[model samples]
Target: MFKDSKKKLSAPATDTLLANGTSFEGTIEAEANIRIDGHFQGDIRSTRTVVIGESAVVRSDIIARDVILAGKVFGSITTEGRLTITPTGELYGKVAVAALVISEGGVLDGTSQMIRTKDAEPSASTDDSDLETQSGTRKDRDTSQATLQSETG
Candidate 1:
């Protein structure tokens, strides 16, 4: 019925889980949340939160609304909301986020770019999907060895 369809549209998506001892290698695209407690290698794109459990080992590029890392990640991560790294987490790559929370004992061995909503004008929205996507050539800055950049509409 129409009522059921409406409910389904508004209801939260069921989270996808990869339990311990599992290993996945490829691209993962999801509209719902995902929790990984095993090993993953590739890219992960999601409209919802992505949680990497304490026993997880991830090596990929991640794009999501929010990312919670309590394990190890080796790649780039872009988050429109908040990126939280727990005490036992270790991240070894670049990160772009609106907000970042790193707990004690957490280690981030790369640069981070803080996306500013005010600077992203015209659209007046900070949603990642609203921005135009483009690939580019790299330019070395005189700053640190690491480079952080923000992409907006």
Candidate 2:
């Protein structure tokens, strides 16, 4: 029905997927989630989450609400929510995110910036605690914050 189609269009896309082993070259935009596990060369913009799989190879700038990377990227990434890098993740460009978590063996060959919204304020739901990291050699740091950042080699 036309109502069903309209509902689908308004709902957030939870699966905008690009499988591994495939190669693509163009711009990608999504309203919610986008997962990529292939070779890509272009720009990516998402209003929600962006996930890059382990075997993926990307060359583009990305702007999203959140990002999870386990592959390799050669461009800048901006996220307002969080950016998490698994052990196999490797990035070679700049990043701007609200929260960043890099596990041991993950690589970040560029700089990072932490940003917070203007209306951001301390609240009961926000935990500002120090996190113990088993990764980078840096000393333990207090991570209790609305903005969290940890760097790894």
- Listed per model in order, the count of residue pairs whose N, CA or C atoms clash below 3 Å is 0, 4
Pairs in clash, predicted candidate 2: 128-144, 128-145, 129-144, 130-143
lDDT of 2: 0.83
Model 1 misplaced stretches (Cα beyond 4 Å): 1-14, 118-153
By lDDT, the best candidate is 1
Candidate 1 residue-wise lDDT at 114: 92
Q: List lDDT for all candidates, in order.
A: 0.84, 0.83
RMSD to true structure for each model, in Å: 14.2, 13.3
Query: Looking at candidate 1, what is the lDDT of residue 27?
Result: 97
Query: What are the models' TM-scores?
Result: 0.69, 0.69
lDDT of 2 by residue, 1-153 (tens): 345543211223448888988999999987869888899999999998888889999999999998888999999999988888888999999999889989889999999998886557555564434223433224333443323543431
Model 2 superposed RMSD (Cα):
13.3
